[model samples]
Target chain A: MNILVLVKQVPDSEALVQVKGEGSGVEVEDRYTLNFFDSLAVEEALQIKEQTGAGTVTVLSLGGQKAIEALRTAIAMGAAEAVLLEDPAFENGDEYATAKALAAAAKGMEWDMILCGKEAFDDSSGIVGPLLAEFLGIPLVTTVVKLDFISEEQAVVVEREIEGGKEVIKAPLPVLLSAQKGLNEPRVASVMGVMKAMQTEIKKLDLAAVGLSQSEVGKAGSKEEILRYHRPPERPPVTMIQGEATEVVRQVVALLKDEAKIL
Target chain B: MAGDVWVFAEYQAGKIRKTSLEVLSKGRELAEQLGSGLGVLLLGSGVDGLAQELTAYADTVYYGDNPLLEKYNNDVYYQIIAALAEKEKPHILLAGATFLARDLFPRLAGRLKTGIAVDCLSLEMGDDGSLIARRPLFGGKVLADVVCREGRPQIALVRPNTFSLPDVQSPAQGKVLPLDVTVDTSQVKLEVLDVTRMAKERLDLTEAEIIVTGGRGMKGAENFQLLDDLADVLGATVGATRGVVDNGWRTHDDQVGKSGKTVSPKLYFAVGLSGAIHHVMGMNTSKVVVAINKDPQAPIFQYADYGVLGDLFEIVPLLTETLKKEI
Candidate 1:
């Protein structure tokens, strides 16, 4: 059995992001980390490989040099191999174009399952996984919180988080699942795993190698163009209520009805 | 196709979702501005009655009533919607950014070879006659304006509650057209075994009038009972930051943040939680924010409309008791 995991490098969740100039673009802080949800995908894939006792895990990422960091992090978590899809033409690609590039890279690969983060932190667009599944012509279940293989390499049962509840879905093997938080607690990489990750050679693939032309990847192939970027307008000032807890409570109850008027 | 603006009227259990109605209301304005007709694509089983309700906001209603589409099967819905878009060729297609639409729209976009802007906060027409979608990015630190420049039938998923519902002037003078589309069940690779409805009586965070959220400061899973008590008295929904959800104190459905659901409740309470930007992005649009924390410098206080520097364990119960007595 084999599993493929998709990883993305993003600024730490706590990092400060600012819009550059009027509406040109954004200037994210230099600090970068593995997207929080992608770590869960790597952890789940590793656990599946361990439970099956005989499966290889390959982690793939799409970005510049920083994306290699995310792949290495997945390697430190026990993935056997890593692939980085990078090229100048892949820049400015939207969710659809990104999924197309990933699908092209995964075509004909030997794998029984594919996993990805429910959404990327930077863009917050949770569209890639489903779009990738469509591009690869496979079934996909998003926001998966619990997953268990029913028949080793045949099928798996997953619990997907929905609006008001969860849906228990069963799909055949070779399906794509997007990992949500609470699936598992990802383990920190040990010294030995970190050393192994440092030594692992990351394979690089471009659009041409993935059988995609310049017109089929990146900004050229993207459906949406970013017109501008700007900061959200400042909100109204907060009114702080100071004093004893009971006093504050009484004042707030009054304010809720008198000022905000919701009560 | 280029002269019509389309909205996907999502329905369930013989009723239309509020977000779908919100989209239709916004789509009506866009259609009027562009001098085009407003059309709604209603898909489900026995949805002919619900389709009539949409006539108040749409100039034409396209009803696709079939048993196969009763439940949202991703593969089946994608095929049906994509085929409809191909045949009708609407200028823009709009849908609410619900879980079902979030999963369905991207695949539909891929199949139609179009671009989609998801969870957009605002939508407008560009000077060049393109669709402009403004959405929060980088955890709400920046708002990016996006446009589908080259795609036909530009698709957008607007966040719920972002737009107000237009008043129904009168029963719209529109025609309901029945769509004929065939779906092959064999192509579906995933099967729904069962759906377990948890928190059936609780309000959904996105649609709630008031929300009480806890964070890592709430301590343990059992401590959430305090939030529940307060929520009950206020008739509000309970939400958690990603930190609390990751700590296993709450399910993802109750999470409010960038990775979680964005809510615009009239009143929001941030108890025992530091205001992280990711968490703030989810509820910053809330009408009134009230924060209660021991730490006066908690980031949540900055975005909150009312700040109470105290222990939530003490203040929450007191507030709940007071509200229970007063209201």
Candidate 2:
């Protein structure tokens, strides 16, 4: 089996986001890292590679120069190789265009299994996995939290923390799966792995190589556009409660009844 | 062939949740504004007996009975809803942004190639009979006004606990429409192997009237037991901040933040969480919020409706005991 994992570099969850230029789109300030969820995807791919021990794990990412670092991180996590679909042209693609570009790259690779995080943290659209599956004409099982190889061609699965409970699915191989966090505890980068990751080769593909042009990438490539962005008003000041527990409960109840009016 | 607006009345354990009814009430108002009829689409394994409960708010109710759909699956429910949408051609579709709706509705939207405004805190009717929806973006940091510009049958996922469930008890007088939906069970490869809910005894966090969340101040994993006790006494769900989940004190499912679930309970008790903007974004919709922490300068205080300055360990247990006695 040839497994391909799609990874995206995003602002760290802890990093503060600023909407630059008085608009809806946001840019990370200070520092950024790989999306929290993608790390778990890379980890899941590595585990499958380890258990299978025969298939090759190739990391595929679509971004600019920053994506090389993300691909290197994936290599350090145990991917056999890394491919970066980067060009100035591919910047700022919407979910549809991004999924199209990714599907093209994935199709060329002839991967048996493709894995991605449920969504990109920055955009938070959560549409790419299923969208790419649509483009690729493959079955998709999203929000996947657990997976076991049922056969060489099929896998039994359970989905992530859904509303009421988990959904157990049996998906055939050569299908698309969007992973969720806790799918696997990501393995830490070993010193040897990190050193090798720095030396690993990153194959870069431009928009033209991926059968696209400048018009097919970035904002121009997007079907939906953000209209505006505004910070919500700050909540009102809180009333502090002091003294003994009994007195506090009395105050809380009275406050809930009188002030908030929920009681 | 024509209807006003439709709310998918989702029932669990044979009782309708407030979230669904809130959608129904909202749908009624929207339908009235459109000068059309309000309706509901009900489908489950054995939910025929509960169709009467749904008719209280809708002018008509459509129930599609399928044993395969008794358990929710993307394929089964979507086929049923998509078939209904194609036949009914309602001007609007609304469902609570509960887990069921979020999972099933989006796929249905994709199948029908329609736009969906998710997690909307409010929905309004425009003068032209279009639905104007207000939904949270960037994980509740900002609210956005959205409209489905493409045309009829705009869908919106109503945020849970944002609106009141009406108490009007008119008999279920609505007409019933049956849909013919074929279930291709083979495509639905997913199954519910086992089901476990954290707050099984207490109210679900998404449906809870009162939610008390803990953070790093709970001290350790064991310390959350206190918050659990408080939630038990209050019949509430125990929520936690990203910090608590990151610290390995609890599962990510229990975390309430931009990365976690967005909940708007009536009363929120925040214990120990410093209230980062991300965490506050999730619970800020709560009608009443109470914070407890030793640090007076914690950011959570800014959004908290009430604050208590002290160690949560000492205060929570006492509060739990006091509330227990009172109840």
Candidate 3:
């Protein structure tokens, strides 16, 4: 089994985002990390390789050279190799264009299974995994919570979560699955692993090299555009209560009826 | 550009979801702001009467009566809505950020080659004649304002409960524009084999009027029974913070946080959870936020309308009993 895991470098969850100018979108000054969810994908792929002991795990990413950190993180987590579709040109690609680029990269790989975070932290569209699967003309399952090997060549069974409940679906190999949080608990890289990861080779691919153009990858390729960006209005000071539970409830109900008027 | 603002009035079973009305209300406001007509796109089998209800808030109502659209399919609904938007170039497109909307909007935007802002918490008109949309990023840790600069007739999926539904209903005298949309069923590849509803009564957390949620301080999964008891008595749904969900005590659907569902219940009761921004984003829209936590330093009180400094284990049970007795 040759499992491919896709990861993206995102602004760290703790980093503050600022919107500048009248319509400029969010801008983060400093600090970024591997998407918290994609880290889980990397962990899951490494676990699959370790447990099976037969498959090679490849970590793929689309971002700048700085995104090599994301690939290295996956490598330190035990991925056999790393592929970075890194280029300044790939910047600002919307979900559709990003998925297309990823699909193009996958077209050249000898992948039997693909796993990715359900969505990138920056975009949060959650459409790329399925969209790339569509572009690749393969079966797609998203929000996968659990996975089990049914057979080597025939199929794999996984739980796909939806709104209310989850569906356990068995699909043939070479399928694409997007993982959600809690699919697996990711382990921290050891000193030795980190040292080894520094030496791992990262294959870089640009737009034209990936069978695409500048117009096909970035803001130009996106169907949607960010017209304007701004900060949310500061919320009013909270109307706090200083009394017993019963008294507080009464005050809350009053405020809701009179001030908030939602009830 | 010539058409009115269109609200996707989503109805499941017979009754319309509250989010649908909220969208209509927001769309009506936007249409008025833009000096355009208000229109609603209603799709479902046996939904002709629902058209009247939608028309109560809209100037025009377009009904697409098809059984295939009764239960939403991403491809089917996307095709229908995309075709409608093409024919009727509405200035602004608004829909609830429900599961149906999440599935259809991005795909439809891709198919139409338009831009969309998803899960917007607030929508307002910009000074420059563009629609400014506020959405959360970094798991609701930060609220990012976004706008579609280039797309014709900007598209957005409004988060549930962010906007209030207007009490004043318009006269149900709008024109019913029944659309004759061709359905290519073969294009819909995914089949819904079955829908197993989660076990519970009342409403889901996202759709609930009142939500009573507990966190890890509640102790164990079994302790959630008290929260459920309170929810039952108040005609509310039970929700949990990420702490509880991560403990494998409850399903992720029950989680109230940035990664989980964003709920805007009328009244939200937070028990034992220290308010993380992620958790607060889910319920911050509630008209009344009452928090019960032993630690005064818990961040929940900062956002909470009412706070109780006591053991939630004791307070929740007492409150539940007292409310049950009073009501």
Candidate 4:
């Protein structure tokens, strides 16, 4: 089995985001890290490879030099190889363009399964995996919390999260699954793994190599344009109650009854 | 190509979802402003009866009743919706940013080569007659106004609980148009084996009128019983912070945070939660918030309407008991 994992580099979730003045755009911070959900995707791939014992895990990312760090991080976590889709033409692309480019590059690879994070933290557009599956002409199951290869080479059963519960789905081989949180705990990179990752040569591909022209993969291909960004208005100031636990509880009950009137 | 504003009326188990009604209400406003008709695309098995309910807000109801669409098959729904958009040429398309819509709309946008703004908090018409969608990004740290600059159908997924339903004035004399489309079964490669509701069967946090959430300070899974007691008394739902969910104390569906489900209930209780921004992002839109924690410095207090600095194990029970008596 050959498993391919799609990875993305994003700002650490804890990092503060600063919007540029007049909504020109968001300022790019230097504190870049592997997107939290994607790390879970890498771990799932590694575990699948370990269980199969005959497959290689390949990590693929689309970005600039910063994204290589994400790929290396995945490599250090036990992925066998890394591929970076890098090119100037890929800049300022929307989720559709991004998925198109990813599908283009993936069409050349031979793999049984493709995995990605349920959504990227930056855009919060959980579009790519499904869109990629559509572009690749494969089946996709998003928000997968549990995955098991029922037939090894032919089919996989997955538990996907839904509104109030979960759905048990089965898809044939050559399917795409987007990893949601709680799928599995990601393993920490070992010292040996890190050393091995440093020596591994990361492969880079551009628009031409991915079989797409400049106009089909970047801003020209994007259908949406960002007009501006602004900080959401702040909520009203909180009214604090200070006292012993019982006293505070009594005060809260009184306030709810008299002030808010929800009681 | 500018035409009617269309809303995808999502339904499950033969009833239309509340979020779809909310979108219809909002779409009616936009359609009136644009001097265009408000239409609803209702698709399901034997859904003609339910399609009539949409007449309160829509001017045209497009009903596509098919057994193949009884359950949502992403490919089939995408194909039908995309085909409708191609022929009808809607100016604006809206759906609730639901699990179903989130899974379907993006694929449709890709197939149609259009832009989509997901989880939008608000929508309006831009000066150039384009749809302006304001969406929260960076985990609610900033709101970005987005537009489908040159796309014919501006697609948007409206966040649930963000808009109120308009009052029913009179039964609208709307036209019911049957959607003629085909489903290619060979295109669908995935099969649904089964769907099981979570064991707890509690109210979903997103739609709950009141939510009481615990954090790591709750200690363990067993300690959540205190929150359950409070929620039962208040007729509320129970939720957890990401830390508690990460600790395996609760299901991910119970998590209230950026990565979890965003909820805006009428009232919220942050019990024993330290108030991380990730958790706050999900509940900050709540109408009234009350925080209870041992530490006075818990960040959640900043977003709460009322705060009680105390031990939740003590305060929660006391509050529940007092509320029980008061009610």
What pairs collide in candidate 1?
Answer: B1-B89
Q: Which residue pairs in candidate 2 collide? A: A168-B191, A169-B190, B45-B70
Q: For residues B157-214, could you state the per-residue lDDT of candidate 1 as single tens digits?
A: 9988788776674857777888895887788877888876664566678767789999
Taking all chains together, the TM-score of candidate 3 against the true structure is: 0.85
Selected candidate, larger TM-score, 2 vs 3: 2
DockQ, all models: 0.71, 0.37, 0.38, 0.70
Clashes of each: 1, 3, 4, 0
Chain B TM, per prediction: 0.91, 0.93, 0.91, 0.93
Write one digit per residue (lDDT tens) for candidate 4, span B1-327: 248899999875566777888898899899989999888998888888887877767888898888777777676788898888998899999998888888888878877778899989899898778999999888777889989976778899988878887666485667788887597778878888887766553557876788999999999999999999988888899999999987999988899987898887889999888999778878877888999888988888888889887778778888889888888
Sort order, TM-score high to low: 4, 1, 2, 3
> What TM-score does model 1 achieve against the real structure?
0.94
Q: Give one digit per residue, the lDDT tens place, for model 3 in B40-119.
A: 88888888888877767888888888777666555567678878888788878888887667656666665555667787
Per-residue lDDT for B181 in model 1? 59
Q: Model 2: how far is B210 from its true place, Å?
A: 0.9
Worst 10 residues of 4 chain A by lDDT: A21-30
RMSD list, candidates in order: 2.3, 3.4, 3.8, 2.2
Q: Which portions of model 2 show Cα errors greater than 4 Å?
A: A19-27, A66-69, A83-94, A191-225, A244-246, B1-4, B125-132, B150-153, B166-169, B191-199, B220-225, B242-252, B276-278, B321-327
Candidate 3: the clashing residue pairs are A223-B114, A224-B115, A227-B147, A227-B149
